[model samples]
Target chain A: MLDVRFSDVRLPSGPGVGYKPQHFNDILKNAFPVQWLEIHAENYMGDGGRPLAQLRHLSERFAISVHGVGLSIGGEGRLDPEHLARLKHLVGWLNPASFSEHLAWSTHDSHFYNDLLPLPYTDATLTRVADHIDAVQDAIGRRMLLENPSSYLAFEESTWSETDFLHELTRRTGCGLLLDVNNVFVSAINLGYSPQGYIDDYPLDMVGEIHLGGHDEDTDDHGAPLLIDSHGCEIVDPVWALLDYTLEKSGPKPLLVEWDTDVPDWQTLAAECTRAQAALAKVPA
Target chain B: MTTQSDFEGALLDANKPVPAGLSDGSGRPAGRRYWVYRNNVAVSLGDALGTGFPAISKLVGPQNFKNLAAIFLRQHPPKSPLMMHYGAEFPAFLEGFEPLKHLGYLGDVARIELAMRQSYHAADATAADPTQLQRLGEAELMTCRMTLAPAVHILRSAWPAASIWAFNMVPGSPKPQAKPEDTLITRPEFDPMPHVLPHGAADFLIALAKGATFEDALKVAQSNAADFDLGATLNLALGHGAISDILS
Candidate 1:
């Protein structure tokens, strides 16, 4: 068996916040014990800028992970060589402690939508995803972790459960899993599944990183509950509880607090990181 | 089995009343779910543009930016999956946009920002050692073919774009009085820095960027403005780390 160990991952005990350029001075001045800092890979793709300067400074001071929103790894047609080249360049440049991307597809033909769209979980889809992952890993010269996406609806064409699809993809491509507990909870609530059951059956050994974020709850026109992974607000109480349950089962992993929209001040996010740390402390690592 | 064409068809046209490629377990229409996918596609692309061009967003309020982005997406959808480099043609779009023609400087401002972004993401290269200039005789130095780093970008504008960009970035900064200004953007280190170039600097840099020798570039600069100072021009290029190679 290949030695795929995530023992190097240094997850925050409680909630951690996304790094914002607004807090550049604050981060530089204060030695905040935030568990880790997660950055959107595309934002710092520049060869040189304040973003790269700040990220390079912070990476030396804290555990850094590159979370990519653009790769469109599951997109139809051939994988984008340019996008893969950029990703490889970034991986070579940063040598981040961990790297991850969404399972959703965001590109079609040559046009990039820049959104993570849902994919049908079928045998053919799994094979395509495995091939993509394999290509990405080969390009970057490092293993990547794939995160499960929060879906509003499931297609009837899906022949496998989300868990089985992710597990099989990891098994086939040798990629790690970035088990987004918030997504699992949101998808379960929207698609009418037991979140607990899904968590219980997940491939825990493959999970290298965890994501906690907020979602919007609304009812569809037909009155069916719909949950959207907005990541605009704080991690709600239910998602927090779900994260706690997931950590208990998966053991301690790198947990990221993702709040992309309506971002609060640095301290407010730092406080959330403290909460994540406290949650992880409750788990016996 | 989903072929590449099937997947492409489904994603390209989310509003395809009855999508040809996708089907639910039963022989039923999956029209409603397509809406979710479509919304995600539009929102994310718009957001990417907004994020990449925050200055553009601020210049044109959120509502206008959204409207502009909607049109721009259809006309110039991203060619690459990388969002950072997604809106290269936005400034060009703004140039021809009917609604934005009233703000003549808006396109120039966008061009300035785009130049800054382009310089920021341009490949990293070491600046030519200043000591090399000392090795050449005065005549040789004047005629030396210097290579400007690819990271250096010079943009000419009829509006004071650098001043405008500074005002927008700095809070409580005075609104820039509309005046024609040329701008220089260079990434000496990791971040791209923008500065207002003195008169004739744009012509000089443009000449150099076109592979002109130092003397030839100086002639272009002097012709553009009789008072063009060679020392000042060289200082500006050297200060920004734009000069990367020199050959006798």
Candidate 2:
């Protein structure tokens, strides 16, 4: 197995906040206690803009981590060559401390959906996912972390459990796990399971980073509990509990507080990072 | 359709049935649960449209804009992963859209928004040193092929696109005048912003953009508007860092 530290990842063992343009000045002027900066890879894909210029300046101060939402590593069709080339170019330029994408697919038949959709985990999918990972790793010349998705539904045809599928994929392709704590909570509540059990079964030894994001709660058609990974609110108590639970076992990985939509002000975001730091402090060294 | 495409097609179009073999993990079909994905796709794409074409969304109001975006998504799913760069066809879609055609200015407004996005994402180039043109004699300067910044965009429209866009963004602004308008977009340093072009500035800029020399561009501008203020236009271009090269 490729050791997480020895892989392309060289992240600092502290909480990082997802970089937003609104907070760029605050982050620089005040010098928040952020250990690194995480940003969506696609947001910086433009040829030139304030976004790219700000990214260049920030990368000089912080360890940049590129999280991709559209690689379609688990798509049924072959990976989009153009998208793959863009990722390669970005990774090559940034040489990010950690680069990662979802285990879920977002593109199908050339139409790129903005959301990450779930896929069935079986022998056939296992081979396809492994091949896609290999291609991504080879193209970027670096190992990437495949994040466990927050799923609202499951496929009956799935033979392998989500944890087992990720374990097998990492084992086959030498990739790493991102291990999103809130996804565990959201998916657990959405599809009936224990978030702890999911984390216990996760391949923690291969995890290079961890993600904690906010989600919205609602009910399904039958009035059962439903949670959507909206990333628009503050981290809830249950998700905070899940993060502490995982940190107790996984020790300290590069934790990121992701608030993509309805992004709060810099102080609020920094406070979220502080809470993550507070949780990280509890983990045994 | 193949199972994957079937699932995708259904997710895109609400009328299509959810693909086979999905479950809610509670001994039921995943149809209702699958609504989460559908909702996510719609909401995220709607948000993308909202940002990419904020003036359009603003002009149509939030609720109507979202409903329109839902229909727009069903017909035109984003072809690229860049959310800001998505909805390239939205302006044209609004033009042909039967329901919105009555608000004919909607298409022109959308066009301006699209132009704003395109200008913002254009390649970064350095502005020409003022001294290069200053060093030239009058005859040499007139024949110089001025290269404009990649971020400079010329938007000519039959509706008052700039005023409509500006009025919506700034509350309590003057109501837009009902007349044809042309605009120039320039990204001097950061965010791309639009400026109202005089009668012939678009012709001047478009000519210069197409490799026209200074004299040639002025000729085109003069033909379009005999009163074209060359001094004012040149000052605007220079102030915005629009000119990148002066090839004599």
Candidate 3:
């Protein structure tokens, strides 16, 4: 069998926060409890700027994780060579502790939509996503992590279950998974599945990192609860509970708290990191 | 069409019904839920444009700006995934849009904002040693060519675009007068600032940017305006670290 399993990643099994420039000074002063930082790859792909300068400084002190938002690993077309080259350039220079992208496709034909669109989990999609993951791993010469999408709806054409598809992706491409607990909760509510059941079936052994973020609650046409993965506010109580549930099974992993929109003050975000630290503390590493 | 084609086609067009295969997990049509994807595509791209051209958004009120963004995104969807590079064609779009043609300055103002963004993200370069220019004799200095820093940008406009930008973006600034102006953007530090260039300086910088020798660029500046002040122009460029290299 081809060795589909990856060795342990370099990130420490502690709390990390998505690094925002607004909290740059605060992080420099006292990044206590927060062990690492994750940055969106597309934001720092510029040739030179304050973003790169701050990143260069932060990488010296913290294990930087480059999380890409633009690779479109599930796009039906061939992976964009120019975007792949850009990703390679960034990874080559930053040498981040880990790199990951989503299981969503945001581009179609020549247009790049600024949203992570859902994909049907069929054999064709599985093959396409696996090929793209292989291309990314080959381009960057490192095992990449694929994050699950928070869906507001599902395609009836999907044959494989989401967890099964993710496992098969790891099996074929040797890429690890970024198990976003918040996404799991959101998808559970929207798709009428048990969040715990989803996590139970998840290939936790293949998970390299865990992501927790906030979601906005609404109703579908039938008044069923619909959750939009906004990542704007604090992780709600239930999602945090989901984190505890995940940690109990997976043990300690590099936990990240992501607040992309309406980012809070440094102390506010730091408090979320403190909560993540507490969850990781419960599990024996 | 494939599932993606149908899904993506309906995403940007709110008028289109939900694609065939999607469900809200109840075996019924995904109606309001499908709007989640539709809203995400439009609103996020709208936010990117709003961030990229704040002055444009300010000039066009919030609701109008939102409407304009809806029309713009459908017409000129982003070619690249990077949000920072999203609105390269927006300035031209504003110029050609029939309803906004009355505000002739909007296009130029958009240009200023776009240039500021480019200056912010351009590659880093070290300023040339001022002592090199000081040590050289006048003849040697005139013969040498200079390279502008990667973050330096020159924008010429018929409207006082920089002054208008200042009045809108910076507080307590004087009102812009009705006159033509040229703007120079330079990143001496982390933040890039736009400066209203003196008369004829844009010509001089444009010449230098195109590899003209100092003497040749100086002539171009003087020819454009009889009262072109070389000392002041060089002072602004050197003070802002805009001159990256002096090739002998």
Best prediction by DockQ: 3
lDDT of 2 by residue, A117-235 (tens): 88888899999999999999999887889999998888887889999999999999999999988999999998899999998999899998999999988888788888889888899
Interface root mean square deviation for model 3, in Å?
A: 1.4
Candidate 1 chain A least-lDDT 10 residues: A3-12
Native contacts kept (model 2):
0.78
Question: Model 2 segments beyond 4 Å from truth?
Answer: A1-9, B171-173
Cα lDDT tens digits for candidate 3, A116-219 = 99999899999899999999999998899999999898888888999999999999999999999999999999999999999999999999899999999889
lDDT of 1 by residue, A8-91 (tens): 545444444578888777777773646578898888776665677788888787778888888888776778787788888887
The residue ranges of model 3 lying beyond 4 angstroms of the native Cα positions read A1-9
Ranking by TM-score: 3, 2, 1
Predictions ranked by lDDT, top down? 3, 2, 1
DockQ of model 1 vs. true complex: 0.44
- Candidate 3 on B1-248: residue-level lDDT in tens? 24788888888887888888788776887788889988888989999989899999889888888999899999998888888888999999999999998999999999999988988889999988877888889899899999999999999999999999999999998999999999999999778999999999999999999999999999999999998988899889989999999998
Clashes of 2: 0
Q: What would the per-residue lDDT of candidate 1 be over residues B76-135, giving only the tens digit for each residue?
A: 878876566778898889989987888777787888777776777676778888778878
